[model samples]
Target: MFKLNEMAVKPVMIADAGFMYAAKMSGQASHYDLFTPDAGELAFLADEIAPHPFYTRGFMLHTDNKVTDLVQRAYEHENAAQYLLVKGSTDYIMNQTGLLFSVDRPSVESMEAIGGTGDTLTGIVTALISTGMNIPAAAYAAAKINRIAGLYANPTPATQVIEIINQIPRAVEKVLKEDHGGSF
Candidate 1:
């Protein structure tokens, strides 16, 4: 990862799932700029003793309500990145200091049952970061964009991730127009 810092223009690094696990295991999670984890994965990060997500303690409930506590624990254990975008029913954007934003509006309940929603969120955040937006702001905006996309897709139990993916352009346009005055 040191090579990343060697670049003339340092890239904003974001990790999810397996990459996040690798970062935590290597004791270098702080080296990255952002981590996008669902509550279950956050539980893994919070458990400093857990070697893998499967080993996360049973006491650490993987529920949306426990997100704040798990985030604190993850930071306390130094197993979190500089920024965390906890993806769940209510997406949370936070840093070491505390929570910055929680996006649950335009809620699309059906999206939860569809696979790749969390991955889609991470991708949106990455794209936003690539556009020169600050990590925290990108995370917040990405959450909004993702939910908006899900809403536009009108997902059902059978909705495919590609259906949501197809709406990303419209979602980005809507979010930027509404939130950023039609520009990134």
Candidate 2:
């Protein structure tokens, strides 16, 4: 598909979280424009750096420098992404140049516990990118929007994904207002 779109006016690819597995297998991860991965998925990418499988969620959770090390290693790997959004307590946005920025706020732990939240983030980023935002900015803004939406919805163990999703407009509005300094 990438080859097919070589002539596209604005060639952009939005990789879903699972694309990491396929890219790892096909050795084509870095070919895409963007990739979204949670900590576990980030670990999976980092595991490719070593001959032995040493990355695990438990270790990532316990180690302070694990994410930084893993991201650096993964960014240098054969299939490293052009733009990567490592989703966790904080979302680390990176490129081949190295860590660009991270977005963490309205820390709703329930957002992590909920399924499809990452998919929602991908959707938000895709929309932003379609609007002419660069991959890095879109990912960063999408992370903030997703979290702000979660906060607006008051996410809890019982909260449904739709509830959080519904708050996206409010979140985007809030961000726009903040960016414009209280003006629309």
Candidate 3:
């Protein structure tokens, strides 16, 4: 979905908290499924509305937990771009850039507040998409790419978003040339 939309225009991250919870309970990883909504993410959504007053649209959710519906509704308004929720979330939309990446991972039980694993997954997606591979391939290559990125970002720092993006192009080239060659 994300990749298909990319063919048309840039995409807004529609995060459905309730839906996310369902996915989580159904065995989906919280990070890849439903991570916290952030400021940057909200800003991206706000930008989606050309004339402002951003109306609620599609939202694919996956989480073992969620906030309130009021919180979600509150985001439907002008200046919503500044809203924290829109700024920090994602979905399987094929917005302008197409399905950039979709990554899932395990969530820590009992512990809340920090979703480092989610961050790592998002980074993995970014790297895969930036590599110029197709959406399916990018999604498929996430685990291996993530493992390589993990080595570069270890210990104290842990999650390195840029590191993932930076390594993507080279990673894609290596994989394509070695495995498929002219097959594709």
Candidate 4:
């Protein structure tokens, strides 16, 4: 359902973080910048100096958590739930690089929760990351997908994981085609 270029890329593990899958293994993906920290580092520094012009009043960004701060880039206003989201964001970021977004998506067996969210996004994020996108960009892409899926999951009150998962690739592709071209 995508435009060509569907060559399969191997699934690299999160356990071994690297610029490229091979690099994490010891600079095997030497040709690529597999797992450099620069992506998140720049995002952090840039936001610190020239924070998003969009953030007003109650708007929050992920600072408490280093990884979420790097991936989320920005956080929308939340009332009582702010504390939990902040905690979750922080926990998620430090542990995950771009892969977590996809991993967090629900699986098909999710009855207690929506299903296949992760499965759907897994393919999308992995593909993009393999195609030379860095962890942050890939993470952002996956996060965007997750958000969309979240919205789709509920579309009323709370987001359902399934809806967000299903719509991720379309949303990601749109961003890729329209706004994202450079580094993460």
Candidate 5:
């Protein structure tokens, strides 16, 4: 539906929320490079029979403990992109083959209650991909960066997403210096 082949440059396609739903519904999910789906959304993608997220089977919803199963199901049904960044208590970075990595350390529990944290993650991954980083690496880095930003924010239930976002620069600096020998 996107007519990606007609584009002069085939840009890396990353989808989340509504865009991700469109990709899955269009049966063009394979055309995308990455999908950032939270656990509940992953259920929607995994339910091949469901026309939309709201219709996903009750049994399949919010099964965070079975994320690997959901990932496998989504891929088997061709409802996922080439790569997936499953965001939750533990962020899972995966490719079509299987799970590649997981990031759970430096976890900021209060970040979960804060709105837009996931959106921030999608933005970070998009920026990393735009810089020409491969999808999987970008996803992994973005997960780490997001968590670091949240840690820097020291968020509370009262904290706003803008507070976490404000720490992004410091987070980026810390991640690059620590993970990439200060050269990224």
Candidate 6:
């Protein structure tokens, strides 16, 4: 269990594509403080993007499949996250001002087939927030750290989620070394 103290300034949110879908379906999608969705889920949010009075879906597979466009649309409408993290071949981090960052390196394509990876990302972001990191920065770091863990795990189609879990500390270490001059 977690406790909130009066000094706590960071707002923690943990949600994925499924929850976003259900919320949108129930007309409460915009109520979330944050959302972490993949490329396909970004498309789902674009269903109601501009020039339309009603919502639509599956347009992600259509000509509107561009991830950036979809993310922009979602941020504009759908009452989406004040900070949005879209996971995919290239992870995108966005806030109301516009795209904050995009992390695409140390890529492991097989990570897509691995289950619980997205959940791992949520955990990483939450932990960062608990330390009082702002949502957008936490999310940006989370995306890169999660991918670095996958690379450290050297994932294969047969690789299980545990391998990725085991490499998280090392991944964080690597990111810290690169970003903090090996002090962490």
lDDT of 1 by residue, 1-184 (tens): 8898789987777899999999999999988889999989999999999999989888886345388889999999999999999998889999999899999998899998999999999999998888888898899889999999999999998999999999999999999889869665
Span of ten consecutive residues with least summed lDDT in model 2: 49-58
Error of 6 at 154 (Å): 0.8
List the global CA lDDT of all models. Answer: 0.91, 0.77, 0.35, 0.37, 0.91, 0.75
Model 3 spans > 4 angstroms off: 1-19, 22-117, 123-135, 154-170, 182-184
lDDT of 5 at 40: 91
| Model 5 TM-score, 2 decimals | 0.95
> What tens digits encode model 2's per-residue C-alpha lDDT throughout 45-101?
766643322434455445575667877877667656788888889888888777898
Per residue, candidate 5 scores C-alpha lDDT tens digits across 40-112 of 9999999999998989998888545498999999999999999999999999998788999999988789999
Superposing all C-alpha atoms, what RMSD in Å does each candidate have to the true structure?
Answer: 1.5, 3.3, 12.5, 14.6, 1.4, 4.7
lDDT of 1: 0.91
**Candidate 5 clashing pairs, residues 3+ apart or interchain:** none
Pairs in steric clash, model 2:
none
Candidate 4: C-alpha lDDT? 0.37
> Where does candidate 6 have its weakest 10-residue lDDT segment?
1-10
- lDDT for residue 80 in candidate 6, whole number 0-100: 66
Q: For candidate 3, write residues 62-181 as lDDT tens digits.
A: 232232332343234222211121112222222222233433321222112323434544455445456555444544454444444433333234433555555555554554565468
As a whole number from 0 to 100, the lDDT of residue 149 in candidate 3 is 42
Which regions of candidate 2 deviate over 4 angstroms?
Answer: 8-10, 49-65, 180-184
Give the Å error, residue 88, model 5. 0.5
Cα lDDT, model 1, residue 177: 88
Residue 153 miss distance in model 5 (angstroms): 0.7
The model with the greater TM-score, 5 or 6, is: 5
Off by over 4 Å in 4: 1-11, 15-92, 95-112, 153-165, 177-184
Candidate 2 has what TM-score? 0.85
